[model samples]
Target: MDLSAVTAALELKSYNKVADILDNLMLQVAADGVAFHNDWPYAIHLLSHFYVHDINSARFLWKTIPSSIKESKPEITAVWKIGQQLWLRNYGGVHEAIRGYEWSQELQGFISAFSELYTKEVFQLLVSAYSTISIEDAALFLGMSKDDATSYVLQQCWTVDSSSGMLTVKKQPVVTEQKLDPRKLQQLTEYVFHLEH
Candidate 1:
């Protein structure tokens, strides 16, 4: 497979195509082991997974990377730490970890793309933590203006009292029985097969 082509596609922000290529590359790597000469492929693959919010796949890739490569590249360790904090839902820790760290151009771009997702994740965490939180507090937590925080809450279908500056999450609609489509079921089966093999 052409790893450079994959890198070029990622540089162009062609995430879906990169994901498909990385999926096959990961399978090949699993069977044949890493080439050991360079670690760019692993870094690119991890960034792709992170871009798509595939935390589990990214974690798996992280664990399988050789410790030698990890030690040689301090950036890999830094990115892994960010991923670990994200998985643990410690958004504050993630912010702290990345605060003063110098990021590669590629890593900075990846973080820029991931910021919107991170904001939503932080919003969800705030909602789970409180029945009603002030917009000011939400803004502080998300590092956004109060107006932006209010807009975000309203966009998520939560109730917001502009006068009181409070946000309330509506009760989630309970799904009685989720009927999976055949295609979805097939996909799940294939995923399980991949996990087993």
Candidate 2:
């Protein structure tokens, strides 16, 4: 498989797109009856799935990876450790796994992207799930220091009570507008009128 496109995507830090590219390449190789496990970068492929927050796919991919490959390539196993943490929703473990490993230059982009995406997701969850949260928990959820988490939440207009050591989350109003297609509505109206007449 020509990895020029994959190299380009990695160079551009288009981490989300890498998984789809690899998925397509894998399909192509399978169609051609080519044995690709030896040449394929499973570690990056696994990380790419996590980068997009596709935990189920990542889990499936992990299960599909050959045991020999998993044993020989410590990096692949390390990447799966993060996947396992994500699967279990072990927020602290996620940060630890990502930070604990020395990732290659090629895979670093995906790891950074995954971390940012995970932090964003956890922030969204916090906004909807909690009106107020302790600074330490917020720090763990955001993979930041307590001071940094306080600063970050404050920037999002979340209030911090000095005495309580808790940050009040600023919930953004969810505007869900139901837009009915005018043409479809009109067609339905006409059909109703015809049936009634």
Candidate 3:
């Protein structure tokens, strides 16, 4: 397979085509029963997975990459580390990993795409972190305007107090069976066991 063509496809952001090409290449490699001899195709394929938000595929590729190549290419290693952090929903770790690195044009493009994903992820994190936060504070944390922050909270079905300028997330109450009839409990257990089988 032509690795350059794969790289060119990735540069063009043709993720679906890249995925197809990578799948074919992987099948060939598997048929030959040989380890990947080059890292560029693997790295580019991994990046394509990231572009398409296929974290499981990316993680699988990452683990397959040879450790020598990972050590030799710091940029690829950095991207993998950041990608892993993002996959794990560790947004702070993602930020820290790329904090001071000098990004190449290609790397910058990947970072831009990741940044878009980060915004959505961060919003969910913020929601989980605080039941209520001021629009101003939320905007500051997310690097958005107060209006945008307010809009975001409303979009998530959270209530915004116009008077207090705070967003309130109404947590759903957890339903637990405090008391269950023995017959009903046995019926539920049987149902679950049958379903499992």
lDDT of each: 0.73, 0.89, 0.71
Per-model tally of clashing residue pairs: 0, 0, 0
Which candidate gets the maximum TM-score versus the true structure? 2
Report the CA-based lDDT of candidate 3 relative to the real structure: 0.71
Residue-by-residue lDDT tens digits, candidate 1, 1-197: 45776877758877646656878876786578666436456666676676677889889889888888898987878777777877886766666656546878866766666666677777767767788888877876675778887887788788888789788975455569878799999999999999999
Clashing pairs in 1: none
TM-score of each: 0.62, 0.85, 0.56
lDDT tens digits by residue: candidate 3, 88-174: 766556666656466667667656665566677677778678889888877765556689878877887888899999888755456
Residue 175 in candidate 1, Cα distance off native in Å: 13
True lDDT of residue 107, candidate 1? 64
Candidate 1: which stretches are off by over 4 Å? Answer: 16-19, 29-37, 124-131, 135-197
Q: How close is candidate 2 to the true structure, as a TM-score?
A: 0.85
Worst 10 residues of 2 by lDDT: 105-114
State the displacement of the C-alpha of residue 175, model 2, in Å, after optimal TM-score superposition: 2.0
**Candidate 3 — which residues are off by over 4 angstroms?**
29-36, 124-131, 134-197
